[model samples]
Target: MSDRAPQPVERQLPTEEARDLLALVRELAQREIAPTAAGEEDAGHFPREVFALLSRSGLLGLVYDEEYGGGDQPYEVYLQVLEELASARLTVGLGVSVHTLACHALAAFGTKEQRAEYLPAMLGGGLLGAYCLSEPSSGSDAASLRTRAVRDGDDWVITGTKAWITHGGIADFYTVLARTGGEGARGITAFLVPGDAPGLSAAAPEHKMGMKGSPTAQVHFDGVRVPDTRRLGEEGQGFAVALSALDSGRLGIAACATGVAQAALDEALSYTAGRQQFGRPIADFQGLRFMIADMATQIEAGRALYLAAARLRDAGKPFSKEAAMAKLFCTDSAMRVTTDAVQLLGGYGYTADFPVERFMREAKVLQIVEGTNQIQRMVVARHLAGPESR
Candidate 1:
């Protein structure tokens, strides 16, 4: 394979500023991220310093309000930035997406005082955040969560375990959803809890198939207390808040998946172009050439699908169905593209000596996270034909 770096993607950005931003991201990814990704991931080390650097550089809050220390960029721009980061390291890209999801409840539903008091620190003050909605028993049926928050005159005592949380133990804050009333969806409420609250704790991170550098754990709230002031939205409104955040979060995953696929495709192309066999490079073979073409096509289609969904969000239109579509297609495409990359490289692809094997493992998680492909299909169907019959 060629020793040279992969070529920069040709992007049709909206403005000179966005173009400049992409250039900076590409440079940062190449210089600071790509070089050590393999080694660090192999060692299962989380690069907290890289996140600190991203925070200081104002890359952590691209889609939020500028008044509150955010970049105020459009969703289109933010998603592209995620793509660049994930191309170098999926851990960094997906971590930023989860942090953004953690911030959404407060940014969208909190009172003015809440925004002014908390937005700056969470956005750019070098603080990380986690979202807590899923429980040990409830993943897809989130409205049925059993976490409880009881009012105590001036405070609420929260008690429950949140499973599969990204940045679980290391985050500075958490966006928690708990049952504040009775029964399903209508009973839930959102709260912004400090990570150091007396009873909050995290289990050891899971040993995952890939992206081992990113921590995923179960966070426990054992009677964790928070003032009423920390409540994000009105009682019985948490499910809405969670769903709204997820609509945007799914788009972030779609972008990350596309980036992974693109990286894999680049690796395959380089390997085939340089690996000679029987008096010629493997790129000479028509079968391998067809595989490369198909991989590139899938990546392009996934990117376009995500960008379209992002544009809808940027325009203040309803984009839930499109977001689900993008997440489903892009992740599935990433899996296919990465698997093809491994096949193209023959024996080397099966070993950790090459990055395609790692990419293949990473692609599997994307399919299952941020709602599974099955959930995405259900979402798309609901949009098309209304709720399903019980």
Candidate 2:
């Protein structure tokens, strides 16, 4: 493990303000996040206070409209911030991404009244949020979700289970998708459900291979009722809203994967340079040097791929294909790079004494989360060859 702090990544920012924002993010990650990461993750402790601090610092909502208390930065800037945070702690970085996804439905599709009433607090007023889409039976096929919302008078009563929800038990609010009519994607509708809404409850958190500090649990809505006023977008438009949010959310995952891979690479470089082998530094060897070169190239390529996707999004161009590609390539690269980092460290990398082992475990989940690499390939293929026929 590297005792020294990892060097800051050289980012290409469009504005001085973005550069300042990145510097602040790096400082905060070093001072507040990195030091306690291993211990907290070992203890399975979620750092709620860290999120509150992020809210206070206006780091929670960088890409939304300033009118809603967001920083009004471009997506490119926001992703770089995510990368910095994830390098320090995956829980915090991925938590911010999920919160941003949770905010997307209402922020992008809600009426002005809804945004004015809810967006401010959700964005930067210290509230945490979760996006509820995948159910026990609906992972990749989110449109097949069975959580039903029945309308009675002016209110809708929700009933069903949402699985694999980050911030599931602890979120201040949840942006949920539920079945309102018929079946399939067209039947789904979006709702802003309070975390404390009646009959809403969360099961015990899932025991996971990694990211134990970040809660992932099953959230149940049993006759949880909210008024029609809480509905986001028109009925039957929820699937589109969810898909739109995911295009951006996948980019968030890509940035985090890059961050993790970079962290692993830094550790490998530090260890190889210091650990003596046959009376000389192991880094002096050709085989190890080639491995390090490959890792660095992968990290740089992943960063560039994600940033390219983000720029397209900021320009209001169609970017779903690129987002999928970035997510696919970056996460796959992270898995490979982290594994090599472990191999480079030899026996030491397999132990909890060093961070590389943990980084390897964390990298595994990135390949599976948001959308799996297989799913990402499907998404990219859809753009090229059209959707699969039933």
For model 2, the superposed segments whose C-alpha errors exceed 4 Å read: 1-5
**Candidate 2 global lDDT:** 0.95
CA lDDT of every candidate: 0.95, 0.95
If scored against the real structure, what TM-score would every candidate get? 0.99, 0.99
Worst 10-residue lDDT window for candidate 1 reads 1-10
On residues 303-387, what C-alpha lDDT tens digit does candidate 1 reach at each position? 9999999999999999999999999999999999999999999999999999999999999999999999999999999999999
Off by over 4 Å in 1: none
Measured by TM-score, how close is model 1 to the native structure? 0.99
Cα lDDT of model 2 by residue, 131-185, tens digit: 9999899999999999999999999999999999999999999999999988888
Residue 176 Cα positional deviation in candidate 1, in Å, after optimal superposition: 0.5
Rate residue 27 of model 2 by lDDT.
95
